[model samples]
Target: MRTVFIFMNEASQAVEIPKDMQFEAVAELEIRREGDTVLLRPVRPNWVSFAHEPTASADFLAERPCVLKTDYFDLSGAGESSEEPGQ
Candidate 1:
C-alpha cells in the first residue's frame, strides 16, 4: 500500500489532530528546553487541498492510503527512534 507521511514542526506542532484521525494516544512529542529556549520536534512529517475539512484524513487515506505512526526516542538512554506507538 502506498503511504503519505506528515511531519509536524515547531510552528504548528501543538495543533490537535483531526477527530477522524484521532488515535488511542498521541505519539510521543519531543520537546527540548535549554536555558530560555524551547524546541518542538515532530517525528518526521502535508496538506490535502481536495479533501473536505471533516473528511480530509479519510480522503487522504483513500488516495495514498496510510497508517498513522508515531516515532519517539528514549531520552534517559540514547535518543534512538522507535516505531512503537508512542515510542
Candidate 2:
C-alpha cells in the first residue's frame, strides 16, 4: 500500500495525488487550494508535519498579518487547537 499524507483544510484536502502517481519512493505530496480546486505538487512526505510552525518573528508578524495552522487536523468542527470552535 502507498502511504500518502495530506493536509486537511476546510473539510477538504489541501493535497491529493493519484494512486498511480504515488510510487513506493514517493510518500509526500504538496498542494495549494483555491476554494474547492486543488493544485498538486511533489514534496518530502516525511517533513510535511515538521513544516507546520510559525516561521515569523514579532517584527515579521507586525509587517504581515497571518494565521498559523498545524499538520494532521480535523476540519468539521474544532481544528487541531483544542481551544475554540472556529479556530
Candidate 3:
C-alpha cells in the first residue's frame, strides 16, 4: 500500500525500497513477477548453498556425531508399500 519510486539503473529498471521496509542484513533480494504484479522477497540462506561452497567452516562440515535430545520418528518402512515394479 506504500508508494515507492521506480527508476532506471543504467539499462535495467530498479525500485528504491524504503529503509523501514528493507530486510535487515540482507545483501540480495529474490524478485519474481506474476502477471502485472512484481514481488520482492528476502533471500534466506539454505543448507544446500552452504554445502556446495568451497570454503565452508570446518565445524559446519565436520562429521561430528550428534545426540538427539528428543525422539525421532523411524522412517525405515517409509516407501515399502506395494506398488508397480516400474513405479
Candidate 4:
C-alpha cells in the first residue's frame, strides 16, 4: 500500500495523490465517508451513479435555517403499506 499526505485547500482538506497513485484520466473523484472509514473511488466512463446522482447544496445537510427552510424530508407518514394510492 502507498502512503499519502493530507493538506489544506481553501476551507477543505485535500490529500496529495502521489504521482504513481494518481488517476490522470479522471477529472473528478468522489470522496465520501462511511461511519469512521473514508473511501475514494475513481469515476469511470458512463458510470451509473452519475446518471441519477443525488445532489444538494454543500450545507444542505446542516440544520441552518437559511440552508433548510422547508420540510424537504418531513415525510414521516406519507408512504405506508396500508395506505391507498392517491389517498
Using TM-score as the measure, the top candidate is 3
Q: What lDDT does candidate 2 reach at residue 38?
A: 58
Against the true structure, candidate 1 has what lDDT?
0.55
Model 2, C-alpha of 27: deviation from truth (Å): 2.1
RMSD vs true structure, all candidates: 24.9, 22.1, 9.0, 17.0
Residue 39 C-alpha lDDT in model 4: 88
Judging by lDDT against the true structure, name the best candidate: 3
Alpha carbon lDDT of each predicted model: 0.55, 0.64, 0.82, 0.77
Q: After aligning candidate 1 to the native by TM-score, how far in Å is the CA of 6 from where it should be?
A: 27
Model 4 CA lDDT for position 62 = 79
lDDT string for model 1 (28-78, tens) is: 556789998666555333245235355445556456645655455545756
Runs of candidate 2 with Cα error greater than 4 angstroms are 1-18, 44-87
Residue 64 local lDDT, model 3: 65
Task: Assess every candidate by TM-score.
Answer: 0.19, 0.24, 0.55, 0.43
User: Which ranges in model 3 have alpha carbons more than 4 Å from their true place?
Assistant: 52-87
Which prediction has more favorable TM-score, 3 or 4? 3
Q: Score residue 78 of candidate 2 by CA lDDT.
A: 43
Off by over 4 Å in 1: 1-26, 44-87
Model 4 scores a C-alpha lDDT of: 0.77
